[model samples]
Target: MFRFEDNKCYRMPAHFGGFDCPGPEAALYYKDAVSVTFTYTTDEKQLASYVPEGFELLRPELNISYSQFREIDWMAGGAYNLVQVSVPARFNGKRDQLEGQFILVVWENKTWPILGGREETGIPKIYADIEDLHTIQPNYYTSASYEGNTFLRLELLGAKPVNGQLLSEMQASAATINALGWRYIPKVGAPGADLSQPILYPQGAEVHSAWAGSGTVKWTQLSWEQNPGQWHIIKALAELPMLEMAPVIMAKGVIILKPNNGRVLE
Candidate 1:
């Protein structure tokens, strides 16, 4: 006989004992992280089309970021890279109205985080080979690909360190980072979802250092034969017009991912 515990987190192969569940306040530490972020203004209508019904597009700005995470506590001192694409938005639910960044897509080099994130937190995660952040002093570069076919590339140039006062100001402004996601679990052998809802994933970062710079991004128009399953996604993103470029930033910090603090939104 088997009994499920309310506090436990379970995934595939349920026959095996489920993994340990961290406390809600427990910190998932990401040490020695370096990230390059590029934000730019895009076509409002085009970006709005991707946002779901219950969400309101806050702006036409799109954010693309790449990071190399080292010595993650949950990964047991392992490392991984990821590319995250998001936009400013607000979630208007029956009982909850929240303003935050809504995730469009996340591509990770490893499968372990992808599985846990998608299944539990409802993050729209997929697999891609994210190259390590290549740096040559003031310049940094990285790219994402599948089966040797590159779909996206990001670069940061002439990055200069920002003073502590400015860093603190920036940190204070973004102290509460609410990441919104949509969880949709398809019914077994069906066209509809067994469970579909919006989720709130809270996170934070403690910046030890930071840099501000100019950035550029190139989104390849992936063909069906090249990306197969993800061609449409890449194509849509590729068509977004980068009407204006915003200031880019590079930061070295410790990221706190509070998965246990995650919850379903109205």
Candidate 2:
């Protein structure tokens, strides 16, 4: 349940710190905050030739199917990456050309799923290999449409929300990830235009953390530097069980086990 890829053909990595796009016109289009924004005119024909690939439609839907959720939890042993954010402001909502950067908030969630039998009613269910009471939190990512009148859609690979319940700021350590969604925050480019959501990760998910081990916090970027006594990895992979629903904005992180032999990477 752990592999993720962006619309443009780049695979997502664990522990995302930030992301950057680098094209020749990079500076011209991406000069504002690290973000994505698009302007839309009601001329149906304008987007007529628009083919929605990579990115999924940011529209009304609910719950991802059971088959679509395995993508977020497939990481190799000792395999980790970063989650980088770029606001379309980098280009001031312009689409001339763009380059993006992914910061280094590099924590890791290594998930592992097993084929558990059916439920009381006999519905197939996947069980996580973690302990009970492990909190499951959701991670959030967002992008805005920009000056090109281009509608930038986030291709949701997981389950869509069943009832518009946005858990962008959901708390808990998580046995699994939950519903993901996109908010409609206009990029007039202000604090109000910031629609990015935060997920409550288990403490010490990062190697160098500040919180004691349980805190709901947000930041501009993230990185991994082993500072054992400082960081905490409380949640286990067994917490997030697999469900059959394509959540739009959220995905399950690696079903991480308790860190015993894992060494800190630079």
Candidate 3:
């Protein structure tokens, strides 16, 4: 149900791991990430808050439960904590002319501050480009509940699947009983919903579940634990007949637009 009508692009979450954010012009996917929740602006306003009004900022709806998010599934492995917001060029009205300086930057992972980093702040700094980002009309949303508070958005535009009809009856019951089609594992979050975020499965992992829809969901878990599952899906005819297995890709999108699946964003 979370389909804001292909507002265009900006699905990045795996910690801005892609879409190139090091420097030299990057950033080209932002289909209205909930308007970035209003680019951070609440300190005296009783801890900042906004429903609509922004350049970007919005990361606070977290409830938390699921074993306290399995103890740190918060995501953003590389690391990014820069706070140098300087936009006094007459924002909103657009003055001073540094391209009208309409700034708003934020990339929070507050490391599980409950749903940590709502829309992942603003994220436009690796030298800024993509037209300087600053727009939002429609994007997508619809996770009122998926068995476990649920809140996966590190990049999931035009996403589709609330329960996907009980996951198409669990992929037709694994294509009529095991022809195969269901291999995603190690994922648990059902209390108030903040499973430390970042558990979007499908990459080549081991453990987790809620509904891979008989689409062959497996991942038992061993090392890095939670989040970052497995997906090489080479050939399995979508998982069934002759079952080869190894080329799967229903892991949802936005990990900065595709950082080769097992990507830490990129």
- Cα lDDT tens digits for candidate 1, 78-139: 99999999999999989999998899999999999999899989999999999998889898
Error of 1 at 21 (Å): 3.3
> Which lDDT tens digits does candidate 3 get at residues 132-224?
112131222211111232222211133233355654553443222100011112346544433222111111111112212111222122222
Pairs of colliding residues, candidate 1: none
lDDT string for model 2 (132-158, tens) is 112233222222111222111222222
Q: What is the C-alpha lDDT of each candidate?
A: 0.89, 0.21, 0.22
The prediction achieving the highest lDDT against the true structure is 1
- Model 2 scores a TM of 0.17
TM-score to true structure, per model = 0.96, 0.17, 0.16
What local lDDT score does residue 155 receive in model 2, on the 0 to 100 scale? 27
lDDT of 2 at 130: 16
Q: For model 3, state the Cα shift of residue 156 in Å.
A: 17
Best of the candidates, TM-score? 1
